[model samples]
Target: MVEIRGGAATSLDDMVFEFLEYGEESSPESSFSSGDGCYDDDRDEERSFDVEESKAFWDEQMKLLQGTFYRTNSVESKIRQATKEVLKDAAYSSQCGCGRLRVEAGGGCRSCLRREVCNRLMNLGYDCAICKSKWRSSSSIPSGEHTYLEVVHRSNEKRGELRVVIELNFRAEFEMARASEEYNRLIGNLPEIFVGKTERLRGLIKILCSAAKRCMKEKNMHLGPWRKHKYMQAKWLGTCERSAPAPLPVGNAARPAKSKASMLTFDLSEAIPIPGLRRTAVEVGVI
Candidate 1:
């Protein structure tokens, strides 16, 4: 029996029972709440890490691109300057030997432009030629062909010949219709016209391809086989055909034979004369 003391004395067993009941009721809820808090913290931490990693990746890419653009040698600069001059003159030229208008400010015929550039470079005493690279489809990539200009220079036998590639639409080559902002920004830094050595071009290709892979991974998109590094390298670095352009004809010999009635000034009446039909104005009544 329990003895009553002071006010009302409770049994020791009741005190222990009450404490146990309280613990049992609160333990699961408290533990569950703690677990949820820890999970949230971990998730937030992971997201922050991902964001930081993405930023670092783009920063590194930008640095590489800027470095590539800034590094240039005297040979590259001389050729680049000459190429620019040729492009300017071609853009303002009346027409090509084929009687077709030259390229305008924004756009024009790239084939003609290439021929003109090759000719101009050749006339300037550079060993220039139009190169075409074609590859058969393989297990990893599809068959494709590319045409561009190259200037080969051999300073000495020991140094071998250095190939300088000239690409007119260099920036467009890497553009994607569906790409992230970071990826597009990276491409925007590329020059519209690229004039560089094979080594420099190879480095640029590696940098761009790596950036493209990262972008696709971040967006959870599949990269196309054609856009792969191997494919891009194959365009310029693979087996190719080099063709020297014919020099532009001199004086009137360059123009082709023109017929009496050219397409631009052809008259149907003159070509087909109807026996009883005359050039007379006849009024037609509307029905």
Candidate 2:
């Protein structure tokens, strides 16, 4: 229902999705309507244009996604809100984790670790997204210093504007569909982001995936990649890329049960140090 525009520049995902969808629609229309074989060649040529457009869009997107963070609602707030939505969706008893609904929350497997397992498989060890979510009347899960969701918010005192990211605990850390969007799909455990990290990152990933499921479930919406905002896409694609956030090692096990991959073996063969993406001097922030 909420078509995100004007609040900020359109995201790269939005552009890519829009472009892809338009190309798909135009393909059928532009083709068969060409009539006789004489004009058919011309029509086919048009399709090549579409192909070029799509390829160009995706190639540009890869650069953006690989870049630094984009500017949107306070990164801290958006991430915090998005994360909480996912966790709240998880606490629900009605949604399912089946592959039934792509965007909306659907079934009962949300709370199951198995569902999380399957999601990891889908995301290539990234985050565990709910397969589906069921409604619940009571969602009173235990709360504590360890149990509470970690959020980073914007600091009023910061120059320009700074979002308070929930401190992505890459150490503990961690969508879908539309014929238009691109997804990192796997049939089954945590996606790429969740395979390793701290409790903070893992916790944040849990919340985001859950919210994403719910958002899609309710309205058939998709969280297009952050690169959709042309501004963000450009920022992310800037000359100086930033390093991925770090994890929270000290408090790794505060809630190990919620994270299954915590037990997996990671190949530390290359004791590579942190990336130099952050060394560049740019007005960028990471959450």
Best by lDDT: 1
**lDDT for every model?**
0.73, 0.30
- Candidate 2, which segments miss by more than 4 Å at Cα? 1-39, 69-162, 166-174, 177-287
How would you encode candidate 2's per-residue C-alpha lDDT over 73-115 as one tens digit per residue? 3333334334434434433433233322223232233223234
**TM-score of each prediction:** 0.73, 0.25
**Cα lDDT tens digits for candidate 1, 202-265:** 9899999888877777777899998999999989888888888766544246667786756876
Model 2 residue 180 lDDT score: 35
